[model samples]
Structures are given as C-alpha cells and as structure tokens.
Target: MVSPISLDALQTLDAIDRRKSFAAAADELFRVPSAVSYTINKLEEDLGVELFDRTRRKAELTPIGRLVLEQGRQILKASEELTALVSQAKDGWEVELRICIDSVLTCEPVYDLIESFQRIQPKTEIRLSEEVLGGSWDALCDDRCDLVIGAEGVSPMPGFSIHSLGEVEFKFAVAVDHPLTELATPLPSSAIQDYPIVIVADSSQHSPARSMGLLDGRSRIVVPTIKHKIEAQCKGLGVGYLPYHRITDALEEGRLALLTLETPRPPEEISVAWRRGNSGKGLKWFVERLQQMTLDPKRGLQSADN
Candidate 1:
C-alpha cells in the first residue's frame, strides 16, 4: 500500500525548498528547525526513501525528493484551486480575485476596468499586487496569484496560457533641464551613450529598443523600482527610458521631456496570463473585466504614440 503523506510534511518540504535552509523554513512555517527535520524524517520513513541529502549546508533534494516535491507542488496547487472553487460556490454571489502586475503603466487600464466591474459586481473583491519583471511569473507559478500582467518577452510557464492585451510604447526621456532634451534634432545613438542612463534593474530584458540594437553598452544607474527610476531621472542622475504612458502627466507639466532618438524603438507587447485548466470564477470574471476595459473608448489608446 502507498503511504499517506501529511499536508504538514508537504508544506514543510515546500517551505524548505523555497527558503533554502531548514532554519529559515522553520521560521516561515512557525516551527523549530528540529521539528521541521522531524517532519521530513517521518515523511521519508513512510516513503522508504530519503528526501534530502544533508551533506550540503542547505537542504539538497535527492532524485526521489525532486519527484516528490514536483508532485507535492501539483497537489498543493490543486488543493488551492479546489478551495477557491468551493469558496466561490458557497458564496457564488461574491468573489475575490488576486492578481500580480509587472508594470505600473498597465495598471491604468486595469484600474479603470476594476472600477467598472465593482459597480456591476459590488460583492466581488479585487486585490492587486505589483512587482518588477519576473516576480509576476513567480507569483503565478507558485499559485500565490490568480493572474499576471507582463510585457511580451516573458516566457510562459508549462501550465499557463498567455493572452496578448496590446503593446506598451517606450520613449527615451530626461529631466526638463537635461542636455539631451536641448538638442534641436534627434540625438544619434552614439551621442546619447555619452550621457549616464538611469534604468530599472530588470527592465532591460523587455526593452524594445535594446532588443533592436538601439541601445548599446553604456554607463547606467540602476534603480530597483519604476517609481525610483522616475525619481532618479527627475533628479538628473541620468537619462531614463520608460513606457511613455507612465510619464504622461510629467511630460504635460514639463517636469520631464521626451528625447527623440535617431531610431524609434518598437513597442513591447502587453499580455495577461493565468495557469491553464484554472476554472475559478473570480479568475474568469477578473480576466473578462480586464478585456472589456481594454476595449472601452474612455480608457483611450493602450499605448502612447511618440
């Protein structure tokens, strides 16, 4: 007979894998390190195999441990889905949706959509979370979030489906008094490189300009968040590149100026993604609302034209 694996053991294993240390996992799981060790030991005894190789400072998964971990993750995800379904059924008239968005620019349309959705479905609760770059993908993969909004270059995970929403146009921008903005004509790529550039830490991968060879290796100041990138630019630390829509107010108020480059960068695609086979009503409703909002005329064009 196959041995039964306890949920506590499975969770402990997951926590250990995620935290990389038994003690850290213990802190997260609210148990002592020895307790976590005991749980794993019990699980291994039941399975008649060792799960982790203890030779390393951190818990290293054995071959069988890897298989068990993969299966455990699937089981946990399914359980969460099941729980969501049950919650939806019991409270069919109300829903709660959780989503993680990678870019702040995409939030404008989504926020408008949520406002409209709440008016129609007042009982539904919506939770929005934002993270930089790959964090959205990580949240979705870990089953911590229901949906993810990201730029084009993000690779879809094995069990997820991606839908193209539209594109986000990027512009080379600088503080109002920055030298690049004083140029009468579009600055050549080589000339632009002479100025220190401020860039979001993980945003280079999604940069349409960089992908097309418009931007070369140049001196750059890196900031951790979109807000910080804009702040860094405004402080005149360096010229910055960002989605045009994100700086519309600043541009209109003359706080920032968009610098015309010799070559225009292509737009990065915007996409909404969710795990495949996910049938949670809240997830379905949230995605539908987002799509509807995108088509609303009052929401305006999805991307800014330079």
Candidate 2:
C-alpha cells in the first residue's frame, strides 16, 4: 500500500500552485527558496512522479501536478471546514459562517453590527470575503458564500432570496483643494463637464446622469475599483462619484469636498441575499444579527431602520 501523503508536502504543493514561483511560494510560506525546492523534490521522490516543470523561471505544474494541486486545495478547504465543525461540536449551538460583501457597503455601519454579533456569538466562526458590487451576488448564486451584502438594484436570480437592509446616499465629491470645491454655488452641468472626471467601470451605463447630458463629456477616465476611484479623487485626479457615508470622514477632515450638484442622485437600497432552500441555523443567526445591527438607532442614516 502507498504510504499516506505528508501534510507538509501538500501545503508546499498548494503554495507553489498559488504563488506560481518557488521564490514567491517560499516568501509566503516563510521558507528559503532552496528549502521550498527541496520539499517539492522530496515529495516528488516519495510519490515517484514528477510534479512540476522547472524549465521556466516560474514553475509550471505538470499534468499530474495540476490534478494533485486541485485536490490539494479541496483537501485544505475541507480540512479547515472539518476543524471548524469539530470546534462547533465541542462548543454546542455554534457553527462556522462565511459571508461575501460588496465593496460599496464597506463604509456602512454594518461592520459594527457584525462585530457585535461576533461578540454575542463567541463560539461561532465567521469569515468575510469582499468583492466588487455585483460579484457578491454571483458568489451567493454559485454557493460560494452563505450570504451576500450588496445594492438592491441587482436582480435576484431564481432560487435566491433578498432582504432589504437600508438605503445609501451617493454624491459627487472631489479633493478639498480641487477647483470645483471653490465654487460658491452649485456648478452648472456645462461647467462641471469642463474638468476631468472619473467614473466607475460601466458607470456611464448604470448612471443616467453620466450619459443624459447632465455632465458634459469634455474629458473622462474609467476606473475599476471603488477604492481606486476614491484614491483618484483624493489625489485630485478627477471628480468622482462616491457614497456620501464613505466620504464623510474625508470631507470632515478636509481631504475631500462634496460638490453640490443642481441635480441630486437618488438613494439606492442595500440588501443581504442568499440562495433559497439553503437556509440553516448558521445563516439564520447571521441574517438576524445583520438586521439587528443595521437597525440600531445610533448608526444614523446608515441604519436600515432609518
């Protein structure tokens, strides 16, 4: 019979697959480059098969290596799940939960609510994954996450359920020293269009104001991430749109200034969603906690109750 595979070898293979280079893998695993190479070499010797092609600077997985790596990732994930399950069993009435969140809602008071929930359910294991707005909904549909926090405009797929958390206000903002911030009155749409503007990816299609002649298209830049959009605005790269709550601190600190517009953008609803027929104790507790935290009176306009 073949001897059992060593966990260390499996970990080395997994790191190599993810990092795609011995040096990169070694850096992540905190091992020397030669040590990483030696581990893989020993694993290959024990398995009696070559696992990687080292012809290139970055190691390429051999056919067997690809198969082993795929299985290794699953094994690792399953091992983590198993450990969580054992811990939950010992603690009683507690379970591990994984959730996905949209980046736009990251500024909301919901984070405090989550922390409070964690405090209340100390035995429960919670993990959060953040992605771009619509990506969280995709993760929920794909069964990759137990719940998704995102904007309400996203259409619910079949076999999915959604719960409204609250509404968020968006506004156009720029750096405090930006020329637009010097205006005593709301700038005309024509004048606003004269400066460089940054829009989120596909934002022109999503926001009518962008294409409806609200802002003249004199100059434009499109960015992918919300954080990048904020950074671009903060750096005086361009006037970008952002959630009002997200920019509140920056506005208060004089890092950014809100530009009053003649036409105001409408508020958008935020929601938490999950697949139907998959609800369980863990999901129930999480959803309940989310609702409670968002409904808290002290959270101001970000609260769902507001």
Sequence-dependent TM-score of model 2: 0.60
- Best-matching candidate per lDDT: 1
lDDT of 1 by residue, 6-75 (tens): 7778899999999999999999988999999999998998889989998888788999999999999998
C-alpha lDDT values of all predictions: 0.71, 0.70
Clashing pairs in 1: none
Off by over 4 Å in 2: 2-96, 107-125, 202-216, 295-306
lDDT tens digits, residue span 154-202, model 2: 6446777778767767787888888887786576676577678776542
Off by over 4 Å in 1: 1-96, 104-108, 115-125, 203-218, 295-306
Please give the lDDT score for candidate 2. 0.70
In every candidate, how many clashes are there? 0, 0
